[model samples]
Target: MNKRLQLFSEWLQEQHISLAFITSSPNVFYLSGFYCDPHERLLALLVFPDEEPALICPQMETARARQAGWTYEIIDYGDADNPWQLLERHMRAKNIKLDRIAVEKSHLSLERYEQLQACFQARSWLNAEEKLRQLRMIKEEKEIAILRQAAELADFAVEVGVNAIAEGKTELDIIAEIEYEMKKKGVREMSFATMVLAGENTANPHGVPGLTTIRKGDFVLFDLGVIVDGYCSDITRTVIFKSATEEQKLIYDTVLRAQLAAIEACKPGVEIGSVDRAARSIIEQAGYGPYFTHRVGHGLGIELHEYPSMNAANAMPLERGMTFTIEPGIYVPSVGGVRIEDDVFITDNGAGILTKYPKELIIVS
Candidate 1:
């Protein structure tokens, strides 16, 4: 059995829960070592408190699951088959009784909940999200190794974007070159949509990349990440096309200072919220408080967003092996935007910065 599965089962037994149904792709990958996008197809892992766990996925993916280190039972179904019926039979074969069952309440759909109701009469539904988050929040040595590789690839991607910039190039043009280079380097997937916001587009923060052309005084922002061996890395860097105005320089400098201060606050035993404050306070004091929106950062790993949200209201303490991003930005509607982001890992004493591309204001001319 997978060690993570064993730990979850022990927790279930202690909670007096009979079973746990994990359906989200990230959680499934974390527990079974197999990652798949079943799309509309059903993919789930049924774990019990004292009995063995079972994996349910599309029949075509069974072999791949085995190749990915799944050694136990796999209840696979074809397109024409009713997976719910198969699941019912499997539960009967194991003599499993649904008393108090645990489930990913947030990920489970209303339709699936109804289907489960037809299968058994469970007295109560327990939420398993918090336990799952706790399990995945801490990274093991091997996981950290994969994350480091992902971060390196992300750094290279930003370098590609920076070098491809020109005065008249469209935002999509640079994005195409960056992704093409990533493909040549064997990156199978991006963690999210490749964002290459130029000029006033950067002021929108989560702006859409399109035919927006780069200009002489524009701030071109490259925010993207790549996936390596099921782990993810996210980074953002903004640079000027030919030159920066004095106001643009100040915005960039303030964001950099705030981001550095936030990274410096990433020590074990410190409140996670304090990390956000470290950056927010700096930007606020610089008179750009309203322009600097959004949280300082978010947890990064198997998924782009994970546990321990880095917001001012979260009071969770930082711990070793916890990896997240420290991104601070200031966007003025009249001017442009400046954001500096880095993937950081909490160390015994300070922080381990995974993304190492130079953050100092770079002039692309």
Candidate 2:
């Protein structure tokens, strides 16, 4: 079993839980090293307090799971088989007993929970969501290495997006070019939807990339990431289409300052909220506090957004090996928004930046 699985098993033992059904794709891949997104299809990892864990997935994924180094028993079901029924048979065959069970409350649907309850006649269900978050928050050396490579690809993607920008190009066109180049370079998937917001559309933090045309003097934002070996990288950068107005330049510089300060505050043992405050204070001092609507950053890794949300109310202390994004933005309605984001990790010394793409305002004509 992987160290992550062992850690989870130990937690289960401490809590006196007899069985655990891990259903989330990210969590499953984290513990098993085999990645599978069953979508609406059933996929689960059954863990025991001391016994070897078993994976229940589609038969099609069994070969991939074995190749990923899964040595434990695998219970795979074909389309004709009811996976849950198969699960019961497999557990009975293995003499597995479940008086009470644990589950990922956040990812397990209500229907799935009902099915498990009927199948096991469990006495109780404990939430293992927070424990799994804690386990995955700390990045191992191997994870960090993969994340660095992912960050490098994210930086390259930004470069591609910027280079693809032109006066007459639509946001969708730019996104297509960026993603096409990523495929050419062997990026298996983007961590999330690639964002390319142009002109006034940039004012919306989560604006959809569309047919909005780019124009000279428009501020274009590129927020994107790529998955590398199951790890993920997230980054954001905004540049002027041709020349930036004075007000636009000021907004861009303020956001950059806040991002830099937030990145600097990512030292070990520091309260996470203070880091958010450090950036918010900067933007507030610039008289754009209300315009900056979101938190300073969020934990980044297996999934695009994970644990340790860097918001004003979170008091968790930063620990070495914790990786997350440091992104600060100011979006003024009727005016464009400026955001500077970088992937960073907590280190013994301080913050270590993984994404090295230039943060200075770039003007492309």
Candidate 3:
């Protein structure tokens, strides 16, 4: 068996689970090396305790499944037919009367879950949602390489956005310019919608770009990310449209300091919550605690948001090879907001900042 499968088998043994159904796109891709088409039909990747592997997919996707580089016993069903019947038949062929079967709770809909339960009739059905999550939390060398490439592309997109910002330009125009540059630079898609907030709109962390025109002396917040090689990179930076006011400068400085402190505190063996606390403390001390509303950051990989979240509530320890972001912001109601974000890779020695964009306040006229 391959390294990933081997690790998964070990985990399954530890959990006393003999059969597992991985249906999430990322998990299926990780195990079967197959990327499923986003459709209404459900595809399942099944791993048994001792068998090789098998896949239950729609008949339409059989060709693509074969080309996914991994060999598996394929059971393809057509539309207007039930796929769970095929699943039940496969289990009988293996002579595997599963006493306990694990399923992805978060990804499985209630209707599907009910169908699965009626079909399988297992002794126990357990939620193994975190099994794949735990496996993906630690980055392999190849995953890190892809993420580095994504981060570089995101940095380039930011540069393009900075240059595109000018007086009289609409927020939507700036977003279009940044997205165009990202695609031109070879990014196939964005991890999320590009956020282009100007003036008071910056106070909203997730403000959508609109027809509002960029004006002089307004703070423009740009939060963007690019998807490259199935990996994602996220970043946020605020720039003055023309020049900064005294209040804007102070808020910007506080956010930068908090972000820097959070990045500095990231290291192996530390609790994930510590990273958020380190940044939150700085903002709170500066009397902008409430303004800094969101969590410090989140994990980045095949999915934009993954395991080992950087939040005060998370208890997961930071381990070497973990990749996440450190984003701290201050959003005042009427005044503009400032956020400085960077992607960091945890190393044995410390954290390595993957993003290269300058954190110093940028004044554009």
Report the number of the highest-lDDT candidate.
Answer: 1
Instruction: Judging by TM-score against the true structure, name the best candidate.
Output: 1
TM-score of 1: 0.99
Better of 1 and 3 by TM-score: 1
Better of 1 and 2 by lDDT: 1
* Per-candidate local distance difference test: 0.93, 0.92, 0.86
Ranking by lDDT: 1, 2, 3
lDDT of 2 at 72: 89
Question: What C-alpha RMSD separates each model from the true structure?
Answer: 0.7, 1.1, 1.5
Model 1 Cα lDDT, one tens digit per residue, 1-365: 87899999999999999889989999999999999999999999999998888999999999999999999899999999999999999999888788998889999999998888789889999999999999889888888889999999999999999999988899999999999999999998999999999999999889999999999999999999999999999999999999888999999999999999999999999999999999999999999999988999999999999987999999999999999999999999968898999998988999999999999999887
Model 3 Cα RMSD, 1 decimal: 1.5
> Which ten-residue region of model 1 has the weakest summed lDDT?
135-144
Model 1 ranges off by over 4 Å: none
Q: Of models 2 and 3, which has the larger lDDT?
A: 2
Q: If both were scored by lDDT, which would come out higher, candidate 1 or candidate 3?
A: 1
Off by over 4 Å in 3: none
Tens-place lDDT digits, model 2, residues 282-309: 9999999999999999999999998889
Error of 3 at 325 (Å): 0.8
Give the residue spans of candidate 2 off by over 4 A.
none
Candidate 1 deviates by what RMSD? 0.7
Provide the clashing-pair count of each candidate structure.
0, 0, 0
